[model samples]
Target: MEMLSGAEMVVRALQDEGVEYIFGYPGGAVLHIYDALFQQDTVNHILVRHEQAATHAADGYARSTGKPGVVLVTSGPGATNAITGIATAFMDSIPMVVLSGQVRSDWIGDDAFQETDMVGLSRPIVKHSFMVRDPRQIPEMIKKAFYIANTGRPGPVLVDIPKDHTAPHNTFPYEYPKKVKMRSYAPVTRGHSGQIRKAVDELLKAKRPVLYAGGGVVQGEASQALTALARKLNFPVTNTLMGLGAYPGSDEQFLGMLGMHGTYEANMAMHNADVILVAGARLDDRVTNDARKFCPGAKIIHIDIDPASISKNVAAHIPIVGPVKQVLEEMLTMLDEQGEVGTDTKSLERWWQEIAGWRKVHGLRYETNEQGPMKPQQVVQALYKATKGEAYVTSDVGQHQMFAAQHYLYDRPRQWINSGGLGTMGFGLPAAMGVQFAHPDAVVACVTGEGSIQMNIQELSTCLQYGLPIKIININNQALGMVRQWQDMQYGGRHSQSYMESLPDFVKLAESYGHVGMLVEKLEDLDGAMEEAFALKDRLVFMDIYVDPTEHVYPMHIADGSMRDMWLSKTERT
Candidate 1:
């Protein structure tokens, strides 16, 4: 075996770990890592305009492909810029490895230029972090970082290496460990039999039962197991925003979503349930409007891989800590053993009838005038039809996001990728790029508002350079839609600076980047324009549609209000 420099060793380790691409920015302290990267032709690197976008793109990559995203940045501000992206990934349970260059080992305490205590700063947001004071620890640390980032609930991990250590001599041998050892890191293999039995008994005895699913289903790849459990038990299932595609919306037992903007029937089910088998959901405040009154009569059985997530925000009757897939699989097996599982046919029929009536009464409908602005719901519905529910749809944070979540029907898990926990605005375009990069064969769409798209518009360059085929559908309302909605409803109809004075021709802007751009003015133009956007191969396409900014997402739980106070419609607010 040939010896290699510390930097070279890192490159070799990354290649060994199956990392094909790394998103990063170059700087002084990390020049050696970049130099080594330049020498090796195997791994591809995409340079982002901002360090934050790099980590966010990495997060999007990891979330889309179920692989550990790799991000590289230099000292101080470079490292700090990556903090938000890392925190986003941490909160969402996306696996990523953030490698940041540091000041030289000797210059660390001397307040060297571009120096910062990166490891300490990133500690809370990462699953694990390490500062390599010695070059010999590089190989082990890299191996351990990958293990930690991919295992358990999966989150970001940081590896900080000083400038001197990057060029250390080649005496250290490279041995990739098969596993990592941690004293406090034993994950549960399966659901506890007693706990699963108790949960089954609770469900069997309860008159009204609801299955609450969350992002943990997608994060843990437990969608199939979750579906099996829901179907076998014959209970209606409702998902949090992050858990949109976990349960099929068309399923008889499925209730659309549960939150402020969730379905009326779903919220009613949560309010009246005698027991809630909360699998993979954390019961966020958005999901549980008034925590004290949430699921008033229900005894919640909370099952999650993260022990801290259980009973942290909302109390639980039974907390089972285990991998979601494992717990769900075990629960399914136990239910099968109980024999002849069937739904409360009469209760289920009544529930479905009520939900169907609610659906018709408050259906997502809008008028198209063929002249002025398109309703936001109309834009989403047209796009949804054009894509045929076969695209990896990612969104930026805004009214468009909530609208897409509420109106769009995603058939399978992992299709709806967006910032759920953090609600970060600039996440859409970069995330869509990352998603396309990870799943090259799939048709991917990035849904964002004009305000949100401007945050990281430079990613268009990355898409062009990489030849990533992405369809960017911008809801160009020329206003901050979400803020405008809130303001219109609560602020005495006084429209503030939410509307911009002048707007750029987004089609021309895309053309400036040598991308094929299209604009739609009529309801009928949507399908044709989307078709053209999809027909273009090996290039990015941009579709800018002007939407009515006055549109607002309803059935919302306002501050200090119970689920009973949900607006439920455009004409009502409690």
Candidate 2:
């Protein structure tokens, strides 16, 4: 082994893990590591404007590529700024390794400069966290961080390295381990045969069944298996917000997204189902508004890698704790072997007819005018048509996000990436940057609202500097559209701080960053603007599409309300 500095060891460890890119913002504390990074040519470092954006970029990189995203940041405020991103990744189970530089070891607990309890601050959000007390432990810590972040239920992992540890003279020879085996960290990969049998038995006996899939299926790489199971049993599948692309949105068996702002057919299916096969999805409050009333008549079969997630919100009659892909494969194999289970074909057809009726009556309807003030749904639909549903789509949290989810049909996994769990407003721009970085040749787009776009709008410079051809679609409504919708519905339209009195001309802002910018105010201009944006292959394009200010997401279910209690629009009740 060659003698190395802690900073050098850090770089070496990253190289050993085949890390090609690192998103980070440097500071005084991480100067040595930055110097080491500067000397290295194998790993490319992306300098983000803020620490939070760095983590978000990494998260996007991970989610799109199915590889663990790496992030580097300084201590104190740097680490604190990364908390929202860390929590965002954690809540969605995205694999990320966050390396943070801490204050010197000798000054521990002395209230040193640029110091914070990184471990304590991050413990709750991170899958695992470590404070590197010794420089020799750097290799092991880095390995553990990556392993924990990517294995089992993928999530963010933080490793805080003290300033003294990175000093040139304080490190020992680096020895990277070939493998890591933690006795207590084993994750179940296969479901029990007996449990699988029971789940199949339930599916065969039910008259009306629904398949609820989530991000876990995407993360577990079980989308094909999920599709096969849904098709073989002739089940209508509904994806959670995080599971948007887990099943083909265009499939006839697909019932669109479920829960608040979910499809009328999907929500109705859940409300009226007799058997619910939930795979890789946690019944979060957003999906099950009132846990007690969620699928009241359904015998839920929950399958997940994390055992604690089962029955945490909605009760599960059969719970299978295992990896989604493996469990689904076994279930499919068992079904083929068992042959027909005497399922009622006529009853299933009748259930589909009822679902079809709901779809026909209340399916994703929106109003638009060709003259002026284009609807957000129209813009999204135009973008989808322009790209032919081939681009990677990321969305900032708001009505625009819901509209994108509703309008754009994603046929493949990893094609639709967004901040679903944490609902971070500033997630889109930075995340699009990451997605573009990961797939430089692929078309990448970010759908953002007026308010959410401003949160990480500075990243446009990052895009221009890196020459990332990310299409930024700003759905300009001049208000916090989702909050305004809530206020309009719940608070008698008081409109507290939801309206933006003065908003920047996004086109001029894009031009200021030396990028192409286009504005679309009329519905007729949307397709042309989207086509121009999609045709660009060299420069980043910012398209500010002005939408109707009063537009709101529909089929909205109130807090603790039943799935059937959906409001079709502001003035229409379903």
Q: What is the C-alpha lDDT of each candidate?
A: 0.83, 0.91
**Clash numbers, per candidate:** 0, 0
For model 2, residues 66-180, the per-residue Cα lDDT tens digits are: 9999999998899999999999999999999999999999887999888999999999999999899889999999999899899889999999999989997766888999899
CA displacement after TM-score superposition, residue 345 of candidate 2 (Å): 1.7
Please name the candidate that would achieve the greatest lDDT relative to the true structure. Answer: 2
**Model 1 ranges off by over 4 Å:** 168-171, 342-346, 363-372
Error of 2 at 47 (Å): 0.6
Residues 1-574, candidate 1: write the lDDT tens digits: 6677788888888998889889999999899889999998888888888888898889888888889999999999999999988988988888999999999999987879999999989988999999997877888899989988888788899999998888845456666666678787676667677887787777766667889999988888998998888777677898888898888766777777888888777777777777888888888887888787677677999999888889987888988888888877877777677687644667766655656665564534444566767788887777788788778899999888988888788778888988888888889888887788788888988999898888888888877788888898898888898888888879977779787667778889888888988888676677788788887867788899977767777767776565556775667664
Q: In candidate 2, how many Å is residue 399 off?
A: 0.6
TM for candidate 2 is 0.98
Model 2 stretches with alpha carbons more than 4 Å out:
340-342, 370-372
